[model samples]
Target chain A: MIGRVMDAGPGEPPIWVMRRRATAWTTPQRRYYQLVAALPPLRDFRRTRVLPMSQRRLEERLALLHPEDLADLRMAVSLVSWRRQPINRTTAEIAAMYEECMAATRNRALRSTVEFRMNVRTVMVALRLKRLGRGVPSGRWGVGNYTRTIESRWTDPEFGLAAVFPWIPEARVFLDQGDATGLESLLMGLLWTKLSQVADRHPFGFEQVFAFAFKWDILHRWLSYDAQKARRRFDKLVLEATSEYQDIFA
Target chain B: MESLVLTTGWMGIFSPLALGAIGSMIGVGRGGLAAAGAMLEVEAGYGRFVGVAAMPSSQTIYGIVVMLTLNRPVSVANSPGLFVLGVLTGVALLISALAQGTACAASISASKSKAEVFGISIAPAAVIEGFAVFVFVFALVLAGSIPR
Candidate 1:
């Protein structure tokens, strides 16, 4: 779909907007802007290889990196100081530490963006648990207004998720059918919507950068999980958006 | 003495033109670069970004107007008035144009990522343009009161 948009010539009523929406970023572009700026030389060096390689080839290389190799890769790309200390930690523990570090960031914009993203992830988890008919472990849900929002929607029959998320109907359909993959995709869509809202609301400053970077992550995850499905979704989105544009132009 | 007075008059007339040229150059240059960069990311709305970039060029037009309004012969007495008015107004236009360019650039960047707020995003740039307009109008009005 992106290829189709890229190949689209002039006289098109800008159907490329939706195609631009789902960009993939290997690193958190905004979060590490300063670091990247500091390592311009390294970036320029890597761009020679990274920009020319196919997405699959790049992923293949990334998949083969060891943790120490990952640390080296980070250093090579970002010039950030790294250590190869032999300490064992579970994914949850690492995530907790990351959340702690993100909370500790002095930049208020970065902090809020991280919080919002974590909150969305937590909401997805909570919804998944609800779908599985399992109870949410106490004190485990992440912070943000979304925690309350999801909890209210789950516990109160009258509180419709559709009030906050217009796409809730589609999500609910997936949930009803017990299509976990579909639900996950819908959850990711909801996340992009929320992030775009935040970015639009705070358009002038750091939030724009944060939104772009995070959306890139979503595109990356979607593409990696299922490239064919991602392509189909993109094609559908392009068709829908193009029709809307045509209506306006007409 | 006559030549010196005549030269001062020429300078007075040229001051706004020179200042305005520099102001508009920086203002338009900055805004144009930003708009171009933004266009790379955005799929459409080229007209909107380009329009915002043109905001800085108004300062130049204002400067030319002020020059025409100060069209009288330079004299010992009126030279001081022309100098003050032309220089101060030119400076105001310059600063306003530059600041407005920055504001426009920021707004363009915001809209590149989120296109829904394109209309409202340019509000800050418009506000900055308002300041430039205020200076332009004030200078034109005040130039009339200066002794010819």
Candidate 2:
């Protein structure tokens, strides 16, 4: 099934193609014994209120990575990071970004991590569109290998992917109930588990370093989700939205 | 054929020291890198990390001892026994040193963050050293019977 999708063309290559390419590249195994030893261990995001190592300290240790590996790591992180993308980016633009990032990433584990993240994001978007009563989106509506599977199985509750992604039903419940925090927490938890698996496979290698950095990002994001801070930001946005209208009425 | 057998005997005698030193160099390098890295994360207890890094060096000592025990005159009668025992001991010591180095590095990395686990974390490396000692002792006992 995946091969059929890849044979279609470069314009709409499946996610598995990225995996195949990543394997073919075979990034040289460089041990970062000193770097791995220097960095403090990271606990699961749910288990900690404070980050074991600060961003500055982590970056200091990451500086020991080979220059090419460091660049690849940064590129992979930027591609997956929600904050790094502008809100106004079109589907085509996002698709292009994915293509460029996947092409440039040499590490197999990092590429797989990025691929996993984008697939999750694509699924979430499909769910959101369904909730809004939008029809099966056409012409590059989202990024990842599952775009076609999602569209063809638009009516299926789990898009025929329940076996591969068991959390989809639970995510749908969160979406329907409008529990944004619950949904966000679920996504982070899943990513954290995935990063852990990746780290275990590539100990003392660049893949492990990337996994640590990605986990730190998740921890940082999770800790920053203060209700009071979010409420303040919400109010500020509301005030800005209505400020111009208020002047016109007066 | 006689000269070849003598040459083989000589090679076997020095194999333990040569192989053990090579293994020690790699093993120590791995542990030392980890120790140096750990130093960046911890303020005190620097001595323990350095100490653990030196754990693989014992293999070189074992190798030297085995070499001395097998250093008898090379002859057709005893050459085969010397060759087998010395080479076998060297290979065992080499493998043990390499494995122990990785264990030591892992222990150092773990203990640096949670200092309480320091004592227990080195247990694996200690177990590996015990295996090297087994080979060392048996090699000595066997060398005495090699018609020296």
- List iRMS for all predictions: 8.6, 0.5
Candidate 1 runs further than 4 Å off: A1-95, A104-109, A139-173, A201-206, A224-250, B1-26, B35-61, B64-138
lDDT of 1 by residue, A136-244 (tens): 3354344444555565567643225556545556765776798867876666666566666776565333454444444544555554556567788999999999999
The CA lDDT at B50 in model 1 is 79
Worst 10-residue stretch by lDDT in candidate 2 chain B? B78-87
- The digit string of per-residue lDDT tens for model 2 on A1-250 reads 1112223366755565656565675767898889989877888887778878888888888899999999988888876764447778776666676776777777777878898998898888889989999887886677767877888999998999898889999999999999988998899999899999988887788877888888888888877776458889999999988998899998
Model 1 lDDT, residue B49, Cα: 78
TM-score of each: 0.47, 0.86
Any runs in candidate 2 off by more than 4 Å, and if so which?
A1-26, A82-84, A227-250, B1-6, B76-80
Q: List fnat per candidate, in order.
A: 0.00, 0.97
Taking the candidates in order, what DockQ does each have?
Answer: 0.04, 0.86
Best by the TM-score measure: 2
- Over B1-148, each residue of candidate 1 has an lDDT whose tens digit, in order, gives 8677667666767677778778788777766766776665556778887787788888888889989998897778787678788888778888888777767776666676677877898898788889878877888898888787
By summed lDDT, the worst window of 10 consecutive residues in model 1 chain B runs over B33-42
